[model samples]
Target: MGINAHFELGLGGFSLDAGFSAPGRGVTALFGRSGSGKSTLLRCIAGLERAPVGRLEVNGEVWQESGRGRFLPTHRRPIGYVFQEPGLFPHLSVQRNLEFGWKRIDRSRRRVAMDQAVELLGLGRLLGRAPGGLSGGERQRVAIARALLSSPELLLMDEPLAALDLASKAEILPYLERLHGELAIPVLYVSHAPDEVARLADHVVLLQEGRVIHQGGLNEALTRLDLPLARDPEAAAVVEVRVAEHDERYQLTYLDFPGGRFTISRRALTPGQRLRLRIHAQDVSVTLNRPGETSILNVFPARLREMAELNGSKLLLRLEVGDAILLARITRKSADHLGLRPGQPLFAQTKALALLN
Candidate 1:
């Protein structure tokens, strides 16, 4: 089951014509540059913007259908919205603010328990604290908890960490990760930050000029040479791996995936623990034949999937390493020197990769 949405709206000079169906369980990130209508499309899904032609359905429940004269108001939609700011009530205590949403639900309709919400968000200690006394990250955590208490079917977060400083963003991201792993309710996250999308999104809806340019699972969409992400300086591909073993002498931990295995700086990780890591395109270099000896520890046999011109100076290669796809950005000179071609056997030497914290 999934959420289906299509919206067409015109606000003055700008127009929005976007539609996409996203998974009903995990987080689906709406990713785009600023002014790309990420927020406008979200508002349309929330029924906050009455698009002239719109249709929204969540797991078979119809929220709005413009052609049938059916439109559920924002308040009636089973949604929880978290904006840039925490938006906690100024006069209320943290406990009361959470209860504001909880108390509104009748006993029979309460799917999320109050205690569970508090625990999931780590809000027990700060219940009595007023919103003003809490830090920016704390307030956001409270806002998320309050939203869950509403028993929403869909959670909408719009740049939830944009207002926070680096420290605050660091503080809140783990909690968000917990939500992504533990919660059953679906989430639609809106953010322009690539790091945020890379760390949290299981799926992506790429928007450009108010249109959905692409939509698919995170890895496929992120590494698509045609997408803008592949051309960015920070362009990278996210790969999920399981901890294989640890090398105590060398202080390294091995991670395994279908693409093969490699070791990283040892962490206090247990065998079989699963995590996602980013492999930056710039960190990858391709060779026509396997190298005899190298300082690089992560080198795997790969086949050239495709290539695209990144710019006049650089070229982007999509390499298939076993079952996984990895991106490599190399100088046009290096590509020409290697005579790269599709389906050519090659070795991808990766210099760096980092686990999503």
Candidate 2:
């Protein structure tokens, strides 16, 4: 099951023509700059902005077909939308606000239970409080819980953390990860922040000037040098690894992926715990031979898969390390000195700058 959509909308000054299909489960991030039609495409899927020509199907169910003259109104669509703001009812208590949505659906149709939503968002203690009394993170968590209580078939979040401060965003990110882990419903997450997309997205759609520049798995999309994401200096490859061991004395943890092992500062995670790591291209360096006595703990053998000239002075190299792929950004002079070429064996050194749970 998956989401299939095609939309073409022409407004006064902007026009949007895009199509994409993503898996039915996990999150698919709509990524681009501010005016790139991320939100507009989302609205078209939700029926908020009627496209002159469109076709949409969710989990094999047709929601819209302009040729057939069939379009489901926003209210009829089984979706829960979370905007940038919480938008909780000021007059109601937190519990009541959450119940407002749960009560609307028939008991037989309810797929998400109240207790499940509460537990997933950690809203047990704040259930009795008012929306005004909650912090930005807490309020957003409640908004998410309320949305879940509605038993939506699809969850649409349009920059749910955009309005929150940095601290608040950090506070709520773990809960979002929990949601990603526990929910079976598909989520369409809209955001311009690359870090957020790398942290949460399973699939990615890169929109530029109302067109989809790329659409694929998060790792493949981010590491493609021809795409906008890879052009950014901070572009990275995301990998999933498991905690293999912990060194309490040194305060370090060893993470194992199919390629090799990564040693980072010890987290609260237990052995066998799964984690996500974002390794920036700039943090990786290529070497012809494994060097002895190096401070960098992560040095693995990789084969050069592709190399693209990013500019006159710099180049981007894509390397295959076992089952995983990594991108390294190095100067053209260095590539020339090393005689880098596709299918060449080399060692990649990663400093492990950023690792997320």
Candidate 3:
């Protein structure tokens, strides 16, 4: 069971007609630009706004069904909401604020224990501190810990890092990463930042003008040439890999994926540990023949799957390596010189630029 929702809302001149389904586990990102109804759709899921024509179901429970005259109020729904700012009580200490919502739940129903939440968010030392005295990142950490203590079935985060400075966002990203991996609750993270989405999301819902343009697994949606993300100059493909071995002498780590292996700078990853990596289109180079000697390490035999005109001067190539896909962006002159065509066998030299785990 997962989340299934449909909503139609009208406010002033704007209207939202959105419907989508998300897996019960892992982060499902709602991606769109400003005024695309990302926030409005999220609010609808939280029951903060009721649409005349709407329906919502979480896992097996029906939270809202306009046709059935059933609608669960905001407080009645088992959800945790985190907005841009940490809405902590200034009068209460950090521990007290966290305990406020936590105490409402029965002991028997507590899925996340207080100590676990404290440890997960690194809030143990800041228990006695007041919200006003904590730094921006610290305040947000406490806010997240507080949400965790509520034992929510679903978590909603609307750009929790948007208000934070670069340093603060950096400070909190590790803790959020831990939460993402450790928690079983599904998260609906709303953000326009591509980097954040790449780092945290397992699934994505592409939204534009109050509608879902596409929604699928992270790799599937990002690799599709027809999608806007693939057409963007900054487009990249995400691949799931696992640590296979470590070369201590060379200080390199070998990661195994569906069809090939990637060697990168040594990381402190354990054997069999899972990882996700981002490979940008521009970082990939196509060669008709495998180089006898090359400095670039992540080279593999690839089959041309598709090609599209990126612009007047450039073309985008989709190459299949093993079972996964990688994108390469090259100038029209380069494509013409190489005589690149679909179904042709070529070698792809890739440089992994970022790691997302």
Pairing residues by index, what is the TM-score of model 2? Answer: 0.98
- Summed backbone clashes in each candidate are 0, 0, 0
- What would the per-residue lDDT of candidate 3 be over residues 1-357, giving only the tens digit for each residue? 999999999989899999999999999999988889999999999999999999999999999999999999999999999999999999999999999989999998798999999999998899999999999999999988888788899999988999999999989988888988999999999998877888889899999988999999887778789988888878898888889999999999999998689999999999999988899999999999998878898888999999999889999999999988899999999999999999999999896657876
TM-score of each: 0.98, 0.98, 0.97
Segments in model 3 whose C-alpha atoms lie over 4 Å from true places: none
TM-score of decoy 1: 0.98
lDDT tens digits, residue span 88-130, model 2: 9988999999999999999999989999999999999988999
TM-score of 3: 0.97
Model 2 scores a C-alpha lDDT of 0.93
**Candidate 1 per-residue lDDT over residues 207-311, each given as its tens digit:** 999999999999998899989888788999998899999999999999999989977999999899989989999899998887887788898999999999977
What are the runs in model 1 whose C-alpha is more than 4 Å off? none
Where is the poorest 10-residue window by lDDT in model 2? 348-357
Alpha-carbon deviation at 168 in model 3, angstroms: 1.8
The per-residue C-alpha lDDT of model 3 at residue 31 equals: 92
Cα distance off (Å), candidate 2, residue 21: 0.7
